[model samples]
Target chain A: MSDSPDSAKKKILLIDDEPFITSLMAMNLEDSGRYEVREQNDSLKALETIMDFVPDLVVLDVMMPDLDGADIIYRLKNDARLKHIAVVFHTATVREAELHAHGGIISGFPFLAKPATTDQMIEFIEKHLPK
Target chain B: MNSVPPDSPPPAQSTLQQLEEGGALSQFASSIAHEVCNPLSQIVLATDLLAGPQPMTDEFRKKIITFLRQGADRIEKAMKSMLQTCAPIETSMVAEDANVLIETALASLTVDASVRVEKHFASDLSSILIDKKHMTEAVAAIFANALDAMQPSGGTLTITTYAKVFTSSEREGWQRQSWFRAGDHAVVIEIADTGHGIHKSQMPLIFEAFYTTKVAGKGAGLGLTVAKKVVDLHHGRLEIDNRPEGGVLAVLTLKSAAKPATFLSQPLP
Candidate 1:
């Protein structure tokens, strides 16, 4: 999959309002060594970071202080360049039952619950990584 | 030294109690400030400690993580409650069974082991149109009050619901019970507790905004007020009163769904 030097590790962008959640998740993702993760504690700055970093996958929080995960997804879906980038919603607000009710995904993006085990996150990360 | 008469009544007061329209905002901010900040502090402390880790066992790590999550959940609760007090943003209503709602509300509660809930739901009870989340919070407010009151004594909490056809005379019993139109059918729910009842003097003030008998931090005194507003939004009536013998009883009556009480052919949730 990695035909180029820069596309070696999967690039990840984590957006959440809570510093603890973003900071801890970033540390955990980077520690896995398969991901190059960048954390944004403010949801408002998501667009700027996404433009600059151009992540392969985005992990967004559903309920945030400024803009929610759905808002970010809308932005991603509209842009021509970013529309194809994979997205996974990570939230405590929306439950698995609710997710399934909406057809196993939110706006065509897979989701993982907050407080997910590191293993569970790893599996999700791997499934969405570029092949 | 001036010795006032022990039995002398207090100074004259206004008969009509008026809560300043904006009083709740300051009180809400005051309470929520602590609620949000404390959790943030815990998360910060735990993350800082867990950082530059030098020898932390899995158990310790789990304990810290638990604290962080719990704090986050508490912050969510406080903010949610505060938001509910403001006004309804958008209410998504659907036909839902009251029994299910009661169960959802009870499940939402973090009741102590000492508290127990007993349900007596009429099998033929009709469904009601409600926004699931808002209704759950409204019902859970009463359930939580009962739990908080009975936590020390470990008493039984009884919840009962039934379909009631309102007669004109019965409608007269409740002032402005228009939520259930006269001669229309409605769903009635009663939640009662074996805990000590509210004081006779305090009963009148119980639902007043920011009026609470609980010490600071235990509650913001907005539960009943928010519950009342949500019930009103649903075109329902909310009542809180003392039981004849002992305890507190909260009754909620809502307009039943248009359809008659019948199970779905395929059983939908």
Candidate 2:
């Protein structure tokens, strides 16, 4: 019943408190023609949006107002229906040097420092998205 | 009973050394990098889209250009705020009306229309010795923080100024310094906002450099730190606490230049 990989655009949901970052990243990913992108600017509503969108992967920001990336991940992992979705942190809270020192993993999740190019984002998505 | 000998020299650790040892400097550096990176991320993505092979419409091109400019402006703003927070502030002290300074600070900001400003100034308020420009900046910073908290769904901002004689009990609550005494006359400026109050856990960290509860790219998180520095330069006390009903209350107390008997005899009505 599943669509073929070539026919289906990969769904990627980006959750960041900054509208500018989310809007820019969404445009960049959509322009590639290989992915479908949705952005959630409010961390509090991120969980509900993620469940509704049913994205293949979620790119999250670490620091937000009410809810943070870690908290969202915790919620996702706790949910039986949502735990299977792939997740990665894209945050400015940690320095690039710190990410490198930690071998690109933070709190047991794949991580990307901010100021990353669209190419870097696509590369990370391709490497992590489940087949 | 255990204390350094009265004749003993103070510890040799400089403020910079202490900051470095405590990892404050590293934290400060990381915060600055974080602030810059948020805008830099947008810039990178915007430029990449512009350079990509995909056909771009005129509307999309204009949007990308706007974002590029916004990102650059954010970076410039962050750099300027950081410099203002860290640089040594030169102050020229003069006797000025607290009400005038508050009004001047308010005039500098473009406040939202939804937010109502209520001023309750004392008619017999005493004049305070302060650097008018620096004090205005300090007051404006506090006002800015209040306004930020009440954004989108605006609220009330209440400002009150009065003269007082610091009692022993009140002096104990403020910073312990030789410059201010229990009987000293002072002018008090209280700015209260009707917005979501700060969490109890965050109370201690609110004054720390680069500590902010706001979303990234909105601010550099140096407003309170700079405000505190300005108050310190004037040998004054600044205190912030959550209000009982709701929101936050910031109090700025400065030594008054007017005679205590004159100002205190006629209390604020």
TM-score of each: 0.47, 0.82
Cα lDDT tens digits for candidate 1, B50-167: 7733457899789778867877786787777666555433566777889999988988878788877788988887778777887899899888888887867698899999988877
Angstrom error at residue A88, model 1: 59
- Name the regions of candidate 1 deviating beyond 4 angstroms: A1-131, B1-84, B169-179, B262-269
| Candidate 1 lDDT for residue B117 | 77
Computed on C-alphas against the true complex, the DockQ of each candidate is 0.02, 0.64
| Per-residue lDDT of model 1, residues A1-131, tens digit only | 12334467789998876666666666666655667888887677998899889998888876453455766777877799788888888765453333443343454677775556555777998887777
lDDT of 2 by residue, A23-88 (tens): 989988887778888999999898899889999999998866676676678788879989898999
Model 2 - which docking category?
Answer: medium
Q: How well is candidate 1 docked (DockQ)?
A: 0.02
Compute the lDDT of residue B31 as modeled in candidate 2. Answer: 76
Model 1 error, position B211 (Å): 2.2
